[model samples]
Target: MELKTLSEIDIISASTSKINQVDFENLTFGNVFTDHMLVCDFENGAWQKPVIKPYEPFMIDPSAKVFHYGQAIFEGMKAYKDTHDDVWLFRPDENFHRFNKSASRMAMPEVPEDVFMGGLHKLLEIEKNWVKKGKGNTLYIRPFMIATGHGVIAAPSSEYRFMIILSPARAYYSGEVKVIIAEHFSRAANGGIGAAKAAGNYSAQFYPTKLANEKGFQQIIWTDDATHTKLEEAGTMNVFFRINDTLFTAPTSERILDGVTRKSVIELAKRENINVEVRSVLVDELIAAAKDGSLKEIFGAGTAAVINPIVGFSYKDTYYELPKIENSMALEIKEKLTNIQYKLAEDTFGWTVKI
Candidate 1:
């Protein structure tokens, strides 16, 4: 039987609200979810109309392709509520484009724009109360797809399930982060799915990242897979190295994720007349700059943290401390981006989309 088409779609909403029971003050990032979700199924070479219903678990066979072949991808974005009682999303179009790119690379069908954006708007409109108006509070949106057909086959599944869930979130990281350079392990390779936000990309970093955590480092700056000598990304964020007055970051390749916040910061810096260099950032050059006191700042940028400063870094078991400068570029960029995100200032780049 064929699935229902998009034209006949009528979103099914949740019956009750969970806003009062939520502890807004004690949010632990993605741990707490909202009351509703959006789900759409892909089958028979067509995507069905999406449904917005109460958040609950769905069952899948143990031999699903997502389980056997890891055909899964997800995107993280946020919806903010300003003091003016309006809800807004930051660069959602970018997320939508990237999600399809990831799906293509993972051999999964793309989610239709209507199902992704329309369903998102409907769900957020109904759950608008969960978006608390404050400095750090916002709704963390997670959109993901998975292969759902039952089989132990190594090929891609014929059926897929796309879901979008919301979680009230605060700051992802509370303090300055300390990082360790990855000298032994690699995060992604030249022709890998690293740039695609595929689900397996993160799981590959767990063991090495755990070892870094044991050494008192909060994250790892992964290097190129070929030599493990050039810096690519810091943990889950794209990294930046500020030497003297120039900002440097590794160009995005198949091994690096094209981070939205990273691109925004580059644009923001260029507009401020800062020289931004996009190229390969070598580990040796970074250590040399650190030794000569030329490395002023090291930070990571992404959708979740926005901008995370690195207080120190470890290489070859030797720790180097970075000075706390008041005029750091990371802080400057973060303030500007946050202001635009929270509606505290004018959005010169037209980045925020009101809901």
Candidate 2:
């Protein structure tokens, strides 16, 4: 497919700036959006010219396929501002590829690189002020596509809308996180849409997650669907378990998301001489390790949290508490990773791209 050039995109500036009114220090995750957004439409078997315009609600038919059949996909990313007041994107190429992968899995049209990357670059350039220069402050990027065809049919929609919205974020999780191990509720089945960042996959988890929330748990460590014997994911991110000195994580499959942060953590761990193993940790094995004092750490890695340490986990009728330890590998790796992101340290892996 021929990629569209940046010059082909139309720019519509907002009449006013909302930056003066926004409290960047007290910003919530994904709540406050920037002044402008990037939008592109897919119609008549081809992608239309992209547009950068004011961030505002647009009309969508009540009978849109997204409302009925749930043909939607999205990607979460972030833009960092270094001390030099320059903006940089961390592995955006990965998110672009993953977004298209989800689109393909959902039977939606794949977005061209020019429309996705080129449009994002232009949009971020226009909203660079939103990318605050600090360690914790960042501009969260959400690129999503939804079926816009006005039809209630079960088939895929012929028309779709892709958009990129920016939000200034502080942190995704606050305080220690406690999670419940799922025994009955399955996140995704074998050969399901779990691997794809489809909207339905997240909506299906809301009920079970809410139940866990009521029980004083912040998240749920989803087990494999069939037997619930293997730990797969933790909430919306890929999970990692540290037993003794080895870090173990489930391999990406039909039922697990191949997260960018998850893979980066694995590589960073190896570079730091941390023993890393890419395999599913059986539920029984985890329980045994917890009993034997081998389960040292549990952390969730994703674009939002980077690396969220799990304070403890509840399984079946018993709750197991992990011992607090100093010099945690989770925190250590997170520090190194964030340093590379903020340009405080050399990016030997070449993950960060300047805007």
Candidate 3:
């Protein structure tokens, strides 16, 4: 794979004439997609030519490594349009950095910085119309890497493919999620691939999450594998607990994904002079706080929902409900972050990237 200059790649402006005729007013997450996509392949130890073409399905070999071994990793982000029709990405560099991190964990080739940014920018240019212009409307971008080599050796593939797809998303509202605290099933263990956004990490949770869903729970709040005393993260998002106006969240470790939104929220909390504690939060401590009325609120942070407040949680047949406030720290920080994303507020942290 000989590297080529960004101008040399044949970027076809072609897009699908027919789209998902669904009403954008009411859309599900990741169900519909835009017309164009960005794709690149890795061979000979380097990235090949990148191209933007119409979104369409392509054939994969029956023995593709990603199919049998689940050698895939992905990142989620959004592009927002301000009131002036300007588009922006919130902390895109972080996502790029983490994408490589996931690639490394999955034994996939790392996508170069210039190649990733260049491909994303070029793709966005072709699909700009897909990005809606409103407070909660934006284009949800999914960048993924998969092992495409067709082999059944149960080892890393020599070839890989990196692609980006866009989906028009409405404001995601889980509506005060009710979570189930895990005491037996663990999402990821120490010295494992939990910190990475590997495809297997998500697929492994389907069964346990399905059980929780049957019990009238939306998601799972995973705990440490050894002890199950310390809280870790949720199925997709990082967890946070607000105790008496003080914000506390578990620090990123080998058992948690170093989420971009989680880090941004930590910064925004400090900027607002909100006391934040980035340490190991014990599940028992939170239960005690809830019993004593110190647990004000609980929320999850991620790029999908931005910030989803957990109204309550259950553990070992015990349920705990959180109090509702007119103005919550979760809501406040979410608005601040989104405002900066849409260029509606001052970008003191320089998180937004103009396209």
lDDT of 3 by residue, 1-355 (tens): 1112267456776634444475778888887888888889998888898888878898899999999999999999898988888777778888888999989887888898767777887777777777778888889999999899988999999989899999989756546589999999999989999999999999889999999989889899999999999998996899899999898999899889999999999999999999999998898898899899999999999999789999899988888988878879999998898889888899999888877
The digit string of per-residue lDDT tens for model 1 on 112-204 reads: 887888778878888899899987888999999999988987898999999999999998887769999999999987888999999999999
TM-score of each: 0.96, 0.98, 0.96
Question: lDDT of candidate 2 vs native?
Answer: 0.93
lDDT of each: 0.89, 0.93, 0.87
Name the TM-score of candidate 2.
0.98
List where candidate 1 sits over 4 angstroms from the true fold.
1-8
State the weakest 10-residue window (summed lDDT) of model 2. Answer: 1-10
Q: Give the distance in Å from residue 147's predicted Cα in candidate 1 to where it truly belongs.
A: 0.4
lDDT for position 131 in model 3: 75
Ranking of all predicted structures according to TM-score, beginning with the best and ending with the worst: 2, 1, 3
CA RMSD of all predictions? 3.3, 1.7, 2.6
After superposition, the stretches of candidate 3 with alpha carbons farther than 4 Å from their true spots are 1-5, 19-22
Better of 1 and 2 by lDDT: 2
RMSD of 3: 2.6
lDDT of 2 by residue, 86-200 (tens): 9988998899999999999999999999999889989999999999998999999999999999876799999999999999999898888999999999889888899999999
